[model samples]
Target: MELRLEKFTKRFGDTTVIKDMDLTVGSGEMIALLGPSGCGKSTTLFAVCGIHKMNGGTLHFGDRDVTTVPAQERSVGVVFQNYALYPHMTVEQNIGFPLKIQKLGKAAIRKEVERLSELVQIGELLDRRPAQLSGGQQQRVALARAMIRKPDVLLLDEPLANLDAKLRLEMRSEIRRIQRETGITAILVTHDQVEAMSMCDRIALMKDGKIVQLDTPEQMYSNPRSQFVAGFLGNPPISFLPATAGAEVVLANGQSIARPRDLQASGDLILGIRPEHFGPQHGEGLQGEVIFVEPQGREELIDVRLDGGGDIRSILSAGAPIRQGDRVNWGVATDSILAFAPNGVRV
Candidate 1:
């Protein structure tokens, strides 16, 4: 079922936690709420689960208005940061606990429990207690438990945060697969950009409890709507160069100045260049002194001080003869630069 939040507002006393937040999750789509701590990503998730009361808003599940729905009646399943599994209960009993509350028959509960355990690949660990299971195995049990209820909407609140880095990487794809296979609309709240970009169909980038951008991973990276979004996405991040208006951008390297056609009149704009876009000089290129060269097995990361005294970086191939104090010619594609305003907003 699709979920919609319209004009959502939440506040504690005078401070607004979420402000006029609006979003939509299509049927079977996984939308991730990504932001740093205190950005209200978790608060928004809690509001969706009815754990936090909204100051004002309307929530709809499909065509039904579930604005005032209670947590249980909302038919939302939640998996928290810490796997909230019962310690004393065996995997079977823990998974069947929800069914017991629903008053299903014993045999039927057993069947449902086994089905979910198999689905999460924990079928063999049904009889084992939570204590005997490893962290990853225990999380699988928790996932199975959440699935047993067959909720209309599934919410994962940083479910992989507790795991080791390697395990976190492994579980993210697994969760995405399960969400797709079950055709359940899912919402994930996380601060890890990689996690959100890798698992979400679309990510809502939030700041101060407000969504600044909502887009696919590629769109967010290649066509960022805001400077914050551009700086927030990608590994190594996007580069910013101090620029001036002199009919066009004048790099101190003696290269001719030319403004992009779209930004001919944009005065004193900062230039955004991705590190990977720098290539060997075709003719006269930006002159820079290589300050440091990091040799990766596949590629080398070269840091250079531009002739204009600004720092710039480049990604070069391995064995590119890049060393400390080596003079290099860096050529940036004409179409690769993005111009941003001084207020950190993309122009």
Candidate 2:
């Protein structure tokens, strides 16, 4: 089912949480609502599930308008951050609770519960209580419960936040596989950029109660529409340096780079470069003093202090013989650098 929110607006008391936000989740496409805390990503998820009433605008499930539907009537299933399992009930009971609420027969509910347990690979734990299972096992049970009803839409709110790093990675793959196999329209609300980039087809990045940019992970990373999106998407986040733009764009250290023709009447511009973009310094390259080097298995993160007095980070292969206090020359491809205007929009 395709979910659509048009001109959606929500408020708490007097403060608005979502303001004229418009977004559409295509049928059977898994999309993520990604942003930092208090950015209204969670609130938007609830709004779609009909847990929070919109102050204005309309919501649709395909062509049917559900703007004022009650939460219980939406046929939406949710898995929250905490897993929210019942300690007193066995895994079978927990997964069957939704079927019981729908008034399914005892035999039918039991059969469906067994099927869901096997689907999530929790069949062996059906007799155990929530306390007896590992965190990852408990999360699988929760996911099974959410899927038991064959919901029209599946909403996951930071569903992996409570697990350890190793388990989170494991579950990320499992969740994506399950979503693909089921072909259910899924909306994941998360603040982890790597999770969003890895699990979903597209990402809707929100900030200050608005959808700032919506696009695929590759587009958002390779060609950010604004400085905020560029800075927020990468780890060891994209570095910036001040530069003067004109006939010859001059870096802080007086090295000139070819100005992009798309930059309209550039005066003062911010040069954005990813750490991985810097390569071995060739002749006429920018000069910097290496300050630190960190080995990250396959790659090394090298910190450099530019001759012009600013610090930037660069990534090199682990085999590179670069070290601290070593004078190194590094070069960046012109196309790899992004220029942003004073107002934070990309040039």
Candidate 3:
């Protein structure tokens, strides 16, 4: 189903939590609602599930306006981080509980439970209780329960947050596979950019209760609309250098660099560069003093203090013999340079 939210608004007393939020999830397309805590990403998810009444705006599932629909009638399945399940109930009972509430016959419920159990690869553990299962297994059970009713939309609230690194990686692939096979419209709420980048067809990066950048992972990373989006999405985070642009672009260190056309307006702007964008200056570039070098298995992070500017971090191949206290010249890839206005908007 195509889920749409138009001018959706939410609040607590006089405080507005969501402000004219609008988002669209195409039929069978999975999107990730990604942002840090208190950014209203999860609140938007709650609104979709009908747990929070919108103080304004409208909600729709396909052509059906479900703005006023009750939670139970929304046909939305939610999987929480803690894997909410009855500890006393066996896997079979837990998976079939929803069907039982709907008053399906015993035989039909049993068959449906079996199908869901196998679908989630928990068939062999049908008789086991929640206590007997590992975290990953328990998560599988929760997923089965959510899908048993074949909901129109699946909402996952940081579902893998509790798992360890290995398990989280495994579940990321698993969830993507399940969503693709089931062809269900899905929305995942997570603060982890990697999770959103890897799993979703598109990412809705939210900030302060509004969608800031809604685009494919590629576009969001390579062409961020604002400084916040650029800094928030990268793993190592982007580095910023104070710069002045006019007839000649100059860094705080008094180093003159090629001026980007977008900054031709000539004023003070911030030059944003990712660590990986810096490389050994084989030709001409900026000169800095190496403060330290940290080895990261396959790569090395070289921290340099520009002659007259702030700290500059560069990611280089681990094999490079660069060491601390070494003077080195590094140049940035022109294509990788991101210039941002003083107001935080990308120039």
Candidate 4:
């Protein structure tokens, strides 16, 4: 099912949580709602899934206006981080519970339960109780249960949050595979930018109940529409420095030309640079003193201190040589700088 939110707004007494939020998921597309805490990503998901009532605007699934539909009647399946399973129910029972509610025959429910278990790689554990399964196993069971009903819309609210880092990666790939195989429209809500970027077809960046930007993973990373989006949706995050229009924006050890368009008419603008945009500065880049070097498995994060008291950080190949307080030169071109307004809006 294609879920659509048109001017959807929600309020809690004096607090307006989601304001004029609009989003659409094409059939079989997996869309992720990504943002920092209190950004209203989950609230928007809940409203679309019929779990939370909105104070204003309309919600729909394809042609049907389902803003007023009860959650149970919405044909939406929600998989939460906690697994939300019945402790006493066996795996088969848990997966078939929804079908049981619809008064389906036992044989049909069993068939669906088996199919789901195999799909999630939990077929052998169908006889076990929730307590007997490992974290990853329990997560698979929860996913299977949600899919047994063949729900038109699937809402996953940080479903991988409880797992360890390794397990999160494993399940991340698994979820993407399953979503592709099943071809079900899905909405994933997560605070982890990596998770959202790795899984979803597109991302909706939420901030204080509003969508700051919505785009594909490549676009979100390459050309974030705002400072908040840039800062919130990166692994090392984006580095920000106060810069104004000039012939050469001077740095600690080096300098580069300001984007002519950026310098045309600007106030207090920020020069945003991504960590991976620069490697080793040959000659025409910022000059700085290396302060710290963190070796992260495959790469090194080189931290440099600018003469103007600002810090610049970038990723280097793990094999690169570096010492504490070593002066280094690197390149930062006009295109690498993202200029943002003081209001956090991208200019």
Residue lDDT tens for model 1, 1-347: 99999999999999988889999999999999998899999999999999988899999989988889888788888888898899989999999998998999999999999889878898898889999988888888888888888988899999999999898888988998899889999999999999999999999999998999999988888888777888888766677776765676864344434666666535566777787877584344677789988887888878888876777777777978777998887677656677777787777
Task: Return the TM-score for candidate 2, rounded to 2 decimals.
Answer: 0.96
True-vs-predicted CA distance for residue 1, candidate 4, Å: 1.8
Model 4, position 274, has a per-residue lDDT of: 80
Cα error, candidate 3, residue 282 (Å) = 6.6
lDDT (tens digit, per residue) of candidate 2 on 43-127: 9999999888999999999888999989888888899899999899999999999999999999999999988888899988999
lDDT of 3 by residue, 161-259 (tens): 999999999999999999999999999999999999999999999999989999999999999999999999987778888788887678877997777
Assess candidate 3 and give its lDDT: 0.90
- Model 1 TM-score is 0.93
- Candidate 1 yields a Cα-based lDDT of 0.85
Predicted model with the maximum lDDT: 3
> What is candidate 1's CA lDDT for residue 240?
76
List runs of model 2 lying over 4 Å from the truth. Answer: 260-265, 281-284
Cα RMSD, each candidate: 2.1, 1.5, 1.4, 2.0
How badly does each model clash, as a count of residue pairs?
0, 0, 1, 3
- Model 4 has an lDDT value of 0.84
Distance from true location, Cα of 285 in model 4, Å: 3.1
In TM-score terms, candidate 3 sits at: 0.97
lDDT of 4 by residue, 1-347 (tens): 78888999899889999888889999999999998888898888788777789899998888989989999888888898899989999989998999999999999999988889989998898899999999999999888888878888899999999999999999999999999999999999999999999999999988888888889999999888888888887788778887655555643234444454544535556777888865575235676789999999898998888765788788887878898888877777566677777777777
Q: Rate residue 199 of model 2 by lDDT.
A: 99
State the lDDT at 260 in candidate 2: 59
